[model samples]
Target: MPEYITLTIDGARIRVIEGTSVLDAALDHGICIPHLCHMRGVPDIGVCRLCLVEVVENGRSKITTSCTLGAKEGMVIRAHTEKILKLRRNVAELLVAEAPNSRAIQDIAVRCGVTEVRYPFHHANCVLCGRCVRVCSEVWQSKVLGFVGRGKDRHVALPFNERPEYCKRCWSCIDVCPMTITPCDGPMKEGEEYLCGKCASQLTMIENSPDSCVWCRLGEGFQCSRWRP
Candidate 1:
C-alpha cells in the first residue's frame, strides 16, 4: 500500500497518496479546481496555467501548477483566491484570443468570466503545452510527431511537414490535444478514415464461429457480435 499524506484544500482536510498531485487530491476530495490541458490518465503538461494555486509553507507563498505539484504533509494550499482567480481569467482570455474557433477555449473563457481579449490577435493558437507531442512520443512510443518550429512559431507535426512511415495513426495525439489542432491523420479505410483518436478501423480475424462481430468481441459496442458471418 502506498503511503498517504494529509493536506488541506480550501479549508477541507483531505488524505491522498504520496505521489498524487494536488489536482488529483482535490478532485478525490470533491474539490473543483478550474483547469485545462490536465486530462486523466495523461501526463501533466501544466501549460494552461489555469490550475495555479497559492501554496504556503512556513509562511512562504508561491503560485504553482496543481496538476504537477504533489501533495505533501504540512503544506498549506489555497486553491481559490482573488489573485489566483484574476490570473486564471487573464490566462483564459489570452488563450481564447489565440484560438478563437476552439469551442473548448470559448467555454473556458466564459467560465473564467472573460468577455474579451485585450491582446492583439496573432492567431498562433498552439499554446506550446506539448500534450500532443508527449502523448505521441511518450505514451504511444511513436516518435512521428514533434515540434517543427521554435518559440512563437512552435508547432507539433511530422518532420519537414511530411508524414513519417513510423506513425501508427493511433490518434493518441488527438486524444490528448487541448486545442482544436490535430497533428496527424490516421490510416484511410472504406472512404472513412479514422480522423481522431476515438475512432479507428483495423482488421480482426476470428478462428472459431463466434456469434458476434470480431470487433464486438472486446465488448466495446462498436459492432454487434451477432453480425459475424
Candidate 2:
C-alpha cells in the first residue's frame, strides 16, 4: 500500500493516497467537482480546465486544475468559490460558442448559468480538449492524430492533413472523444478493400502491432492466457 496524505478541500479535511489528484479526492469524499473531457480510465489531458479550483496556501488563493494537480499535506482547496465559479462560467461560455451544436457543451453552459457569450468567437467549433489526441497517443499508442497547425488552427488531425494507409480500422479515437465533431459513419461494405467502422480511419494505425491485455499485464506481470480464453 502507498502512503496516504491529509489535505483540506473547501475547509473539509480528507486523507487520500499519495499521487491521487485533488479531483479524485473530492469525488471520493462526496465532493462534487464540475469537469468535462475527464474519463476515469483515460489520461488527464487537463485541456477542458473546467475543474479549476482555488487553492489557499500561506493566505493566498490561486486557481489550479484539480485533475492534474495532486493533493498535498496542509493544502487548502476551495472548489466552488465565487471567483472559481465565475471563471468556470466564462470558460463554459467560450466552449458553447465554439461547439454550438454540441448538447454536452450546451448542457454544461446551462449548468454554469451562462446564457450568453461575451467574448468574440474566434475559436472553432472544437473545444480542443485533446481527448482525441490523448486517446490516440496514450490509449491506442498511435501517433496518427496530432496538432497540425498553430494557434487558432491548432486542431487535432492526421499528419500533413492526409490519411495514412497503415490505418487498422480501430474506432478507439471516436469512442473516447468528448466533443462530437467526428461523426459515426457505418462500417464499409464487402466490396471495400479496407473497411472503416466509425472513425477507424483516424486511429487504425495503433492496431498495427499486437498488444497484450491491460489487465493481464498488471495482474501477473505478463500476458495472461485467461483473457484470450
Candidate 3:
C-alpha cells in the first residue's frame, strides 16, 4: 500500500507521498523556495541553507531547512514569512558579497530583495556549496575532484591537487558548477547587447572601450544575449 500525507504550504493544501521533503512538495505545487545547492535527481545536502521555511506546531513557529524536512500529515508550512525573507536576504547578501562576479548570485540577490551587503566583501571565487564535488563523485563517479583542506583553507581541488591521467576529459563538473555561470542582463540596444560577465568586466581592463558581442558565457550556453529582432 502506498502512503500519502497532507500538508499546507503558505495556506495551499497539498498531498504528497510520504517522506517527501517540504522543498520538493512546495516545488511540485509551483511554489519556488529560494535555494542554491538543490539539484533535481541528485542528493540534497541542505548545506546552502537558502530554502529555509517555517513550520508551525502547536501554535509555535520554528525555522527549518525545507529540503531536509519531510512533509507529514497535517504539517503547516510557511515558506515566505517576514522572518524567513529577512534571513534569506541576509544569506543572499553574504553570498553576493563573497562572489559578486557570479551572475547567479547577483540574480539571487535581486530575488531575495538584497540590495547591499553589510559584511566586508572577501571577493572569493568559490562559495564552497560542494555541488561540483558531489556531482563528480556521485553522478560521474569519477571522484576526480575533492576538498583539499579544512575550514577556511578548504576548496575543491583535483586529485592530489593535480590533474589526473585517468581523467575522462568530460567537463560535467564545469557544467554543474554554479560559479561557472556568468549571466548577463541583456537585450540591450546596439552596443549594449552581449555584455556577459566576462565581457562587462573588460571595461575595467581598458578605458573608453566600446562594448561588442564577445559571445561570452551566456552565449556559449545559447542563452539570450542578443537584441530582440
Candidate 4:
C-alpha cells in the first residue's frame, strides 16, 4: 500500500508520498532551494550540503540536509529562514573560492546571497559532489571511479587515475553536472574539449576530427546543436 505524510514548509501545508525527501517535497510544491548537487536519477548523497533546512521535531529544531531527510507526518520545516540563508551563503562563499573560474558557481553564489568570498581562489576543477563517483558505481555498475584520500586532500579518481581498459567511456557525470552546463564562455582551444550547454555547443574536437563528437566522458552527455567557434 502507498503511504503519505503531511508536513509544513514555510507554513505551507504539504502532503508527500512516503520516502519523499524534504528537498524534493519543497521542489514539488514550488519552493526553490539553491543547490548544486541534486540531480534526477542520482542517489542523494547530501555531500553538497546546500539544500539544508531547519526542521522542528518533537519541540526541538535542528538544521538538516533536506535531500537526505525524509518528510514525516506532523513535521514542521522551513526551507529558507534567516539562519538557513546565512548558512547557505557561507557554503556558497567557500565554493566560489574553490571554483572561482566557473560561471555557474559565480551565478549560484549570487543566488545564495553570497556577495563576497573570504577564501582565496583556488581555480579548482572538481567540487567533489560525488555524482561521477555515484553514477559510476550505482548507475553504470562500473566501480571504476572512487574517492581517494580524506579531508582537504580527498578527490574522485579512477584506480591509479589511469584510464582502465574496462572503462565503457560513458560521460553520464557531465550531464548531471550544473557546472558544465554553462562552461567556458571565454574562449575555445583547438585539440581541446568543451562542454557548453548554455551556448548550445557540446564538443570534444581533436585537431584531426572536426565533425565527430563520438567520444565523451559522458556519452550523449549534454543536449545541444549549436557548435560555437
Instruction: Kindly give the number of clashing pairs for every candidate.
Output: 3, 2, 0, 5
Give the number of the best model, judged by TM-score.
Answer: 3
> Residues 1-229, candidate 3, lDDT per residue (tens digit)?
6699999998889999988888878776766576777665567888878889999999999998898888899999998788998998898888876766566666556556665667666656788988787878788788888888898998989976688976677877787666776556532233222213344343333223111222222223422212112
What TM-score quantifies how close candidate 1 is to the native fold? Answer: 0.73
Where does candidate 3 stray beyond 4 Å? 183-229
- Report the number of backbone clashes for model 3: 0
TM-score of each: 0.73, 0.71, 0.77, 0.76
lDDT of 1: 0.63
- Top-down lDDT ranking: 3, 4, 1, 2
Model 1 Cα shift for residue 183 (angstroms): 20
Report, for every candidate in turn, its global Cα lDDT versus the true structure.
0.63, 0.62, 0.69, 0.67
Candidate 4 lDDT over 1-229, as tens digits, reads 7798899988888899877888777766656565667654568889888888999887889998988888888889877788898999888888777765455665556556565667766756788888778877788888888889999899888888797887778987665554564344552333232222332222222213321222322212232111111
Q: RMSD, model 1, all Cα superposed?
A: 13.4
Stretches off by above 4 angstroms in model 1 are 181-229
Q: lDDT per residue, candidate 1, 117-217, as tens digits?
A: 67655445566767778778777888888878677667777887887888888977765555553223422233231212221232122213111123322
Residue by residue across 120-221, what tens digits does model 2's lDDT show?
A: 543244677776777777777777888778887677788777867654458776655545432123222233212112223322332231111112121111
TM-score comparison, 2 vs 4, better candidate: 4
TM-score of model 3 (CA atoms): 0.77
Best model per lDDT: 3
